[model samples]
Target: MFEQSKKYFSYILNPMELLRTKKVLQVNPTVASPRAEPEEIKIFVFDYNAAQADVRELKTVPECFAFLDSPKTTWLNVDGLRKVDVEKICAHYGIHYLITEDILSIGQRPKMDEIDGLVFCLLNMMYFNEKDSAVEIEQISIVLGKNFVISFQEDAAKDVFNPLRDRLKISGSKVRQNGADYLFYSLIDMIVDNYFVVMEKLGEKIEGLEEDIVRNANTRTLAKINMLRKEMIVLKRSIAPVRELVNGILRSDSDLIEERTEKYFKDVYDHILQANELAENYRDMMMNLNDLYLSNVNLKMNEVMKVMAVVTCLLAPATVIGGIFGMNFENMKWLHTNTTFIIAAFAMIGIPLIMIRIFRKRGWF
Candidate 1:
């Protein structure tokens, strides 16, 4: 787990690698690699009304466009952006190139923008990868229009929208009676709600680290604390912009967002705020854990130093007596008899005992 955390922290430090886009000049257009074959795009289209609903898998962009023309509220979920003709899809939906650029880019900060009758939003979705034992972040871009809502994701391997899908399948679900705007809000809410799950995992790791620090303060424990601190920093960076994005949506005057839907967004906005607060609390706890670990190590060092000082003090008088007796001066009285050696031995042992008693009385030990 510690090794996984270290690897993830390194990735967070250099997040550009996650995007795989390179800009050659200051004003040059960004270029992406075309070497790798793109994964086959899977499209899920849902046409639903107040009473009934239809869900289908679209094989081509034409199918997606045809589904958009339906009278019912249409939801087009495009999974896997690689090797797909994104330009044609954006053209069909009236999405601007800038918005498509943000969609294709992997490392975009969470943001909301309105342009030409479309509400464009970029969000970061987080989930814990149990197999890897690390937090994984992916960008989810949403485009909301008058009659339809489209979503783009980088990978189709994992998604947090399954619950929302289930809710849509039920006839009496709140999402069934609402329009496309509500569906957009529902999608955002689902993404934000998963933040709590990631935070819960992070909270668990923080508590575990706290317990470990108290029980066995060592270099490994210190390393784990620092790794958790890095993870929290990355999480905070990811969530802070999302709060601003949601706040912007709440205050937006865009026609794509209805007045009724604004209240739902406000709820999501509150969730983001809560997530940020929890992250801040975790960050502060990590710092405190680090300080506690250092204090424990310093305390141990001080104890060792105290013992060495006492031992040195007790041996000082014996060293002086030995030095005086080894001198060549014949006038020394104790050096003329065997009693001198015996008395010297007694003094060596007796003086240290007396000093030890003095030290004990003074509470030095």
Candidate 2:
């Protein structure tokens, strides 16, 4: 009993051993954010208005101070979370420490909250790893202030906001012509749009996996199905809550969110509702794939068993005749003549052929 208990708990006791022996999932590498530099975190400010927009990178958090109260709408994007830098910057904006903690933490659920003098929105950015067919996630926190929108990202290496960035460069686009609230709306819209992109890739994966299951299902196929099940759960977990977050924004009374911006946020709400539905649809699809895998496996096994049963039946007559004649001291019918051997052989061969014909006629193969 003592040894069995030790065996069960060994993995926890020696994590190094577990790490050495565990099988790691292999796939294309995800884009990972490098650890923040001890001296600085990456910060980019986009200060844009109807006439013109300025895009620049700042070396320190304090540089964002100039845009805080600027009449021109400002977007400050911070990548990589440095505790000191985040605290200082959030402190400057009067963000609550709890909210700052939530911002710096990775893997928070999608949510919206009003804190201090600003409205904060949290989101999870998802990436599909095509090679392994898995889902990877990053956390995003957006703070809408009086005249600026600051986006905090867990990964500095990649995000889905490049199109929004390019639109900021356009001279007369709505993003360029609007206030900070519109910019905030644009940011949320881009993130939700990315859910569709990830879902599209997953849809393609579903098609491919469905084809593979139909053609031939194997243990490898089972593993793939399980992986897709997990990915769907991850997608759903990240996507489902954003609908409520968007709805909350639509209902919020924050002055930072302008009246005109409510329509834009409503558009985001509709997009999220669609995304949530897609996530749910894909989840159901994954379950169907699992059922398909199981049904195909059972069908294959039944085929093997059917062939075995047919072979056994075809040999039964021969077995009975041979066994009856082999008994000691027997006066078996037709056992004394050479023609008897030939007749018995013919009976054995003929009976099986008749059985085969009957089986074929009945379409029982």
Q: Which candidate leads the pack in lDDT?
A: 2
**Model 2 misplaced regions, further than 4 Å:** 1-39
Every model's TM-score: 0.87, 0.89
Q: Report residue 76 deviation for candidate 1 (angstroms).
A: 1.3
Supply every candidate's count of residue pairs whose N, Cα or C atoms clash at under 3 angstroms: 0, 0
- lDDT for each of the candidates? 0.81, 0.83
Give the worst 10-residue stretch by lDDT in candidate 2: 20-29
Error of 2 at 361 (Å): 1.7
Q: Model 1, residue 159: displacement in angstroms? A: 0.8
Report residue 301 deviation for candidate 1 (angstroms).
1.7
